[model samples]
Target: MRRMIFRRELKSNARGLVIWSLVLGGLVLMMMSVYPSFAEDAQTAEEMLNVFPEPLAKVFGMDTLNLGTYTGFYGVEVHLINTLVGSVYAALLAAGMLAKEENDHTAEFLLSKPVTRIEVTGQKLAAVLTNLFMLNAVIAAVSFACTGFADEAVELDILVWYLLATFLLHVTVASVSFLLSAVMRRTRSIVSLALGIVFLSYALHIMAGLSDRFDFLRHVSLFSFTDAAAIVENGGLDAPCAAVMVLVSLLCALGAIGYYHNKDITG
Candidate 1:
């Protein structure tokens, strides 16, 4: 049962991965254009770091861009921009994925198979994980080329840690989207809410970062965990934020499973 569902998910996501790879490759090429200018400036990496807004640059992973005497450009392009773009893309993709089947009335056929609901859910998750990894792999490859062009030996350790932060954020988004699928009656509603939530969370995080008065708002927004700068240089997920992600995802997964289990398949 698991095998069958997994295969179905893989087949569905294959095209998505391909399209994403092309887009990600193009973005990498574009960001890489900044490297020559960043490298040639007589300014030290620390000085370049001083120019961007503290809130803005931290959001873009400026803290980790400073690796060696000559290796900060990679952090700005790969860690900062990649985290922001990747989180939104992954959220949208996940939000539409499962709910579309229910929206199309195809869930009847898919669930009618001999497989149990648990196996079906597992397969869907497997497909989600595969898609997530493939997208990151695309970015990693293209970013490799960018790093190479910078004429500095890149630090693989920081890159991998930043990717891990990305992975956690991706899974958290997928779980929320899946829960919304379980809650909402229509695919259009799911997509709208998912995208809206992503942007809303981001705005709240930015606002919270700008003023200590708004810091309380940060706890309610998931974008707090999307801090690539802290993850890349600090080599750890922020403990409190990480806890929030884990708690939210686990609760959402449980809610989704229970919702679908009791849901009237015919309705």
Candidate 2:
């Protein structure tokens, strides 16, 4: 029964998963392809970035612009977009998985089966993790392959760490969205609220960079914890930030399980 539920969820969500993976992978490839051209006239590109106001530069992650190298250019150009898109994909997938059952008026029938709520939640969560894992794996492979387009050799170690941090960040966001899905009764509300949380977190990250007055917001925004510039400069995963993501993901999963196990699902 557990395997059946897992396979069913995976099959149901496969098309959406494949579409997101291709979209994200194509975006990463397109962005990485532009790196060689920028590297050719790195100084001019850097000077162009210098014309922006300091706060604006910081908000766009141009404060540490170094286009001469692959890692630096990727950090500036590709990382944030990749993070944003990947996080949104994760949130949407997680929220939709459970909530759709309720919204489509299928939950009553599903729950009437021999499956317990815990089993349903566990199977669905497994499917969510599997889809997230597949999405990240595809995009990471695309990003790694696209590095070959750069003039200089990219640092494989830092690239690996950056990708790992990005994956963890997606997991954290997806777990939170999953928790919301378990609590919310409507699919539309779940997706809307999930996206709202993502954009708000991103806004906080931008605000944190804009001024020290909002520096404290960094602690709350997941974006700050996964800052690409910081990851590239540090040359490894941020241990404290990674730990926080893992902790939050675990807690959210536990909360989702508890709530879903007790909730009344009626059509």
Candidate 3:
């Protein structure tokens, strides 16, 4: 039953995923056109680095330095933008994926199955993950192609680690959305709440960089740990910070499971 529900959900969503894949592909291509030049010479790399706001780097994982290599350029544009934006965008999409049906009362035929709600919710999340991974794979392919013309060898270890961290960030966002849907009554409210959390946290992260007054906001938003520059330089996870994110994500996932378990089937 869970499998049946998941298949239906994925089939329904296939078109949107295809559209998003194209949009992301375009973003990657646009970045590729300019990024290669940015790292083509020492002067270009230095200039590219300088254009980024110093404090803002902390919020986007810009602390890493690839030291004038393809990895460095990839980190600057592709990984960085996706780190800040992709994670949340994917989450918003996932959060309302299943819950929206319920909120709209379109889930009746599906939920009427003999399967338990947990199975349904869990399988739906799995489907979301599968879709998200496909998107990530598309993005990664473009990135690898862009970074292929390297003056220096590829840093596979570090690049993979950072991308993993970025993907985990998306998973966390999906969990948060799922948790929200379980409690929020209206789908409109759910969308606003999901997007609000992502955008608000992002705005706060930026504010934290610009003002000391909002400095404390750094601890709360996931974007604070997404510093692409830092990841590229280190080529791996920020152990302590990554752990904190995992814990928070676990809590959100658990909350969603618990809430759904007890939630009345009103939708």
Candidate 4:
């Protein structure tokens, strides 16, 4: 039953997986295609960035990273889009996984099978992890390929670390949405809620960069944990941020399983 459920979930969500992977990869390709033009006028670009308000520049990672270098340019541009849109993808995917069974009036059919709620939840969670893994894997491969074609020298090791941090970010956000799916009432569209969560977290991350008063938001926002600028500069995720991402994912996933196990399901 577990195997069946896992396979079914994967099959049902396969199109979404493909679409998201293509969208993300396409964006990376489109953006990297412009790197040559930008690199030629890197000095002018840096000068233009400097004219922006200090806080605004800091919020977008123009504060510490040089736009001329590929790594810095990637951190400020490609990586930011990757994390932001990737997080939204994670949230929306997770929000629908289990809850859609109920929202689609298929919960009763699933529950009638020779399967326990635990099996259903566990299988669905497994599917979510697999989907996220595949998406990130595609993104990483595309990113590496793009970097290879660029004229600038990029640190492959740092790119690997950045990709890993992005995977962690996706998992953290997915876990949270998975829990919400387990607890929220059946609904056809949880899209708004999922998008709200991602944007709010992004806002917090921006605030953390913009003001010392909100500096603590750095710890609260998953975006901060996976900051492209920081990853490019430090060569990897910080110990504390990695720990927090792992801890949050674990806690939320466990909570989702627990709550979903006993919650009543209706057609």
lDDT of each: 0.70, 0.87, 0.71, 0.85
Where is the poorest 10-residue window by lDDT in model 3? 58-67
Identify the candidate with maximal lDDT: 2
Ranking by TM-score: 2, 4, 3, 1
Candidate 2: lDDT of 142?
A: 92
Candidate 2, 1-267: lDDT as tens digits? 758889998998899999998898988888888888888998898888889899988876677647778887777788888789999998998987777888889999988899999999999999999998999899889988888887676788878877888899899999999999999988888999999999999999999999989999989999988887778767787889899999999999999999999987866
Q: Candidate 3 vs candidate 4: which has greater TM-score?
A: 4
Total backbone collisions, model 1: 2
Cα deviation at 168, candidate 4, in Å, is 0.6
In model 1, how large is the Cα lDDT of residue 147?
A: 65
Better of 2 and 3 by TM-score: 2
lDDT of 1 by residue, 60-136 (tens): 55644553322355555555556667777777777766677777888889887887766666667667778888888
Candidate 4 lDDT tens digits, 213-244: 89899888889988877876676888899998
Q: What tens-digit string does per-residue lDDT give for candidate 3 at 99-205? A: 78777786666667798878877877778778888877877777677666555777877667657877777777777887887767677778788888888777877
Clashing pairs in 4: none
Error of 4 at 145 (Å): 0.5
Best by TM-score: 2
Which of 1 and 4 is ahead in lDDT? 4
